[model samples]
Target: MHNVHVITHPLVQHKLTLMRRKDASTNSFRRLLGELSTLMAYEVTRDMPLQDIEIETPLETMTAKVIDGKKLVLVSILRAGNGFLDGMLNVVPGARVGHIGLYRDPQTLQPVEYYFKMPSGMHERDVIVVDPMLATGNSAAAAVQRIRDMRPRSLKFVCLLAAPEGIATMQQAHPEVPIYTAAIDRELDAHGYILPGLGDAGDRIFGTK
Candidate 1:
């Protein structure tokens, strides 16, 4: 889809490959996730609007560019999404951070929202929803719908990896929001895991398993 962007930067690819290894240590996995998130953040924010203003550099006055409109609202889809939040905040330190906690039922496979809290005046801000893996897309899509109900001026999705099924599901449900991901792997396994994905992102990121 035109709105979906797959970051192909060499550094991102290199780090992603390292993260896929079964023997990768927890420390290494966390480090790579941070590094990869930094790269992915760059691509995700490439189209942010800019405004020109006159500025005095010590030597002379010059027109400078700064981000336009309201500061961004970084919404992390809890647990796994936190892994990407650190790097994104590194790039946008002044951004407001929010959290949405949701889980998919094992049998029904439907998303159930347990928590959601956003900054005041979120409707006036640009929202970026972050998660590490987009598998069934149910969670991401549901999360977006929840955020959309808040009426942000703009919305976007960012993840480290994605499955084709997930991407399609997201497009079908929320095509207006673009998805920025590091890689689009083969397909989803029977259990809904992305093929070649770095296992459960939450486990890999937090060293729980």
Candidate 2:
């Protein structure tokens, strides 16, 4: 609870509810996710550092505050993580984008990374990792660990929904990095899906299933 932030804004809650419905179409789910991601991104970057810069209005010059262009980096955890990327990009169009491809080993239920690519000068940027569902948290933890190896200036994890198990897993692995989620579901099912979750995010978003 200390480092986990649950966004309770009315708009965010409303959109998340629509996403959780059992009958929502793929198009509806994808559209809702895109809109919800934009709202989540607003909360994720609310505390980003800003510097005062000289600017001119129509009539007079004044000091204007702006976030550091190079201060932010978005790392999508492949597949489902890509769902949050485009919407978040709308919020921070200039932010650099990165991707980390990982899949859960069905037998071991552990994350196996097959690809990793990040922006240059990661050490100077604040990395925000995106993944839709944090069911077991293994993939999120592994992805964060890989990014940590890069020694970025800061780190944060954002997800649409998370389970208690997932949250604890991430906390134990990286307590310093806060988690932002729209909701914390009841629990994870035997198959590692979050109970009452919106189902497989990548599948729903991409109509894969």
Candidate 3:
């Protein structure tokens, strides 16, 4: 609850409903995810700092405003994170891409990192970490902890669906980082999945199930 940004746009909500249906095909789910993430990305970066500089217009010279630096670093948290990454990239095509692979231990539900790679100059760029669902918040928390170690200029967390339990966990562990999510569901189920959620986002996106 520290800094949760729940998108309430009609388009975002409508697409999310389609994704929640149990019968949504993998292709449809993936496509809708892309569209929804784009809308969420717009809200996430809406307050981006802008700077004015001299510019040449067709008629005459003038000052124009552009995002400060306009360089962003996007980190994907393994499989499900990839779903949001693509859409965000459409918003900032010049952003640098990073990937972190973390798997959860079934019993403890703790995250174990298997891979980590990022662009250089993380310290100079604003970073946004994407994960489709914030379930128990284990992997998302661990991923944020790792990224914080890099000491980026700023950091934001984005996810498609979030559970209250997951949001509480993130607020406890990384209260400094704000969260941008499409919806905050009621609770986390026994297996750490968000109730009334779109099910396994990775599986639905990749047609693994």
Best-fitting candidate, measured by lDDT? 2
Which of 1 and 3 is the better model by lDDT?
Answer: 3
True-structure lDDT of candidate 1: 0.90
Query: Deviation in angstroms for 75 in model 1?
Result: 0.8
Query: Candidate 1, residues 1-209: lDDT per residue as tens digits?
Result: 66898889999999999999999988999999998888788888887878899999999999999984346999999889999988888887778898999998888778899999999898788999999999999999999999999999899999999999999999999988999988999998888889988898899888899
Better of 2 and 3 by TM-score: 2
Any runs in candidate 2 off by more than 4 Å, and if so which? none
TM-score of each prediction: 0.95, 0.98, 0.97
- Cα displacement (Å) at residue 72, model 3: 0.7
The candidate, 1 or 2, that scores higher on lDDT is 2
- How close to the true structure is residue 165 of candidate 1, measured as C-alpha lDDT? 92
Q: Which portions of model 1 miss their true places by more than 4 Å?
A: 68-70
Window of ten residues with lowest summed lDDT in model 2: 64-73
Q: How does residue 150 of candidate 1 score in lDDT? A: 91
lDDT of 3 by residue, 1-209 (tens): 66998999999999999999998999999999999999998999998778889988889999989875346889999988998888998988888899999998989999999999999988988999999999999899999999999999999999999999899899999999999998999998889889988899999999999
What range of 10 consecutive residues in model 3 has the weakest lDDT sum?
64-73
